[model samples]
Target: MSAATLAAADSATMLRRYLLRMRRYPSLTVLLVGMPVLLLLLFVHVFGGTLGAGLPGGALPGADGRGRYLDFVTPALVVAAAIGAAQGTAISVAMDRTTGIVARFRTMAISPVSVLAGHVLGSVVQSVLAMGVLLVAAVALGYRPGAGFAGWVALAGFLVLLSLALTWLCLALGLLSDSVETASNLPMPLLLLPFLGSGFVPVESMPAGLRWFAAHQPATPVIETVRGLLDGRADAGTAATAVAWCAVLALAGWAWSLRLFRRTTTG
Candidate 1:
């Protein structure tokens, strides 16, 4: 087989390996799905009514405060679910490193790219699965989205791009960490980005300094784009900005990860 074909075969095998690992050890998947569901329930049931009443325009017409809040917050929760999956990717990568598995692979005839590719593909699948479950939970809680078929398509594309970007970044973080604990903790800040931005509340409602920061941050545009797409009123500018951010992050993470992986494996 050609080098490309060999690499593809190797990557497929590695992907299967990662997926089986996930199935055999289901705690990570459970945590990834459960945390977002719990947060969704807590926000919509406990705090939704009060918070929804405070939205700039108040609740939607014919909708109660809790329902309104559920609609508003579901996109952010989906983003949070993606972030949680990325955290799992980092931990998985770190485990491979510390367990001497990666070192063992280096001595074999496998394609070097296959290892990282497996993690990226596996994590993206996990992220999408978690987001799907979260969305179902949101719908069950009376979160009604205004998205039509096209809007749903756009939303899925954007989510896949976001997950791909985040997965690569976490892959780099995993390769960078000296220990699994550190890898697990390094991505924690990403989980907070949605909350700190326009995830839980409107950016305009924040203090001046915080509001400016929130509006300018990457997460805000991302969340806003998701919100807009779901409402079938996506802004061209916000979508462009979000796509640009994803492109930059994906490229940076891919370069950083490849460099680190080569250095660690070959040196």
Candidate 2:
């Protein structure tokens, strides 16, 4: 069989299965669309002043302290949609395992690859919805964007890449985790890593050890690239670094998650 034909068959199967999952549970679809807006509001109104002070605007001098804090945080929160959206896959997978949905999928004739791809696609849909909602809110809050339409598109593209990449890691962990509770905790490290990184503050403000980690960490690259794009800075930015890290995570998690997923069902 030709490799091209095999790839085409696999893509078809993946899309079919993903659409089926959407039909099976529409409530999850709602949650995915809603959560990012919730997070954005919670940050902007409740924590906006405090958090805004930290962004381009706020109380900070030299920086666009006069800028809207919501604008600064919008990208990070958009990136954060990945965490929520990706976790949906983990939670759903764990539930599927407990209820025997995965076992049923295992018994099917189509390649098991659909199981992974469906979850990723579902998560991306959720992330996109959440980001869109948050963007509207950002604009309402007087957040004038520095980037034009192209820059905005770039921002969205980055989030999608990062979202899909980290999702596999979450999938691997969800498969290995014994319960839904445990799977939820898996994202905390990834989420907090950004805070420790340059996402919220400059790396220089942190301790030497932390500064070193934040300087080289994945989230830093991702956030810096995001900030640059969102603010429309001419800098080459951190997307290159983010792409490198995403590739590493995607490769590592795909291999590791597959091993763990197979074990969970077989054992």
Candidate 3:
């Protein structure tokens, strides 16, 4: 077989390995999916009424505050779910590195790209599954979106891109960590980006400085794009900005991970 075929086969094998790991040790997957669902319930049931009232247009006609807030916050929670999964990816990568599995792989004829690509693909799948659960929870909790089939397709595409970007970055963080605990901690800051951005509330509601920061931050555009796509009113400019941010992040993380992987494994 050719080198490319070997790499593809190796990557698939690695992906299956991680997937089986996820099936066997399901607690982490539960936590990753559960956290966002819990948050969705809390925000929509507990805080939705008051928060919905504060939205620019107020509650939708004939709908209660909780319902209105559900529609608005679901997108943000979806993004949060994706962000939360990155921590899991980082920890898994770090575990493989520290457990000597990665070192063993280094001695074999396995393709180097296959190792990292496997982690990336596995994490992306995990993240997408988590997002699906979150969305289902949102719909059950009175969250109604205006998006049609095309809008759903666009939303899925954007999410996959965003997931790829985040997964790559977390993979790099995992490689850079000296310990699994450190790897777990490094991705924690990413979870805060949504809260700091236009996730929970509109940027206009924030203070002047924070509003400026929130508008400019990468997460805000991403959140907005998701929100807009769900509402079927996505701005071309915002979508472009979100795509650009994802591209830059993915490239940076891919380069960083490859560099770190090469140095650590070969040196």
Clashes of each: 0, 2, 0
**TM-score comparison, 2 vs 3, better candidate:** 3
Taking all chains together, each candidate's TM-score versus the true structure is: 0.97, 0.83, 0.97
Estimate the overall C-alpha local distance difference test score of candidate 3: 0.92
lDDT measured at residue 155 in model 3 versus the true structure, 0 to 100: 97
Tens-place lDDT digits, model 1, residues 1-267: 999999999999999999999899999899998999999989988898889888888664323888888888999999999999999999999999999999999999999999999999999999999999999998887777888999999999999999999999999999999999999999999988998899999998999999988998899999999999988999999999999999898999999999999998987
Model 1 misplacement above 4 A: 59-63
Model 2 stretches with alpha carbons more than 4 Å out: 1-29, 54-67
Q: Model 2, range 1-267, lDDT digits (tens) per residue?
A: 665566557656765666677778778766766776787777667766665566532375322342455666676776776777777777876776777887887777645665776676666776777777777877876777789899988887877888778888888878877788877787668777767787556677789998998898788888778778878883564677787888888888789878987786677
**Ranking 1 against 2 by TM-score, winner:** 1
Please list the C-alpha lDDT of all candidates, in the order they appear.
0.92, 0.73, 0.92
Clashing pairs in model 2, backbone N/Cα/C closer than 3 A: 56-64, 57-65
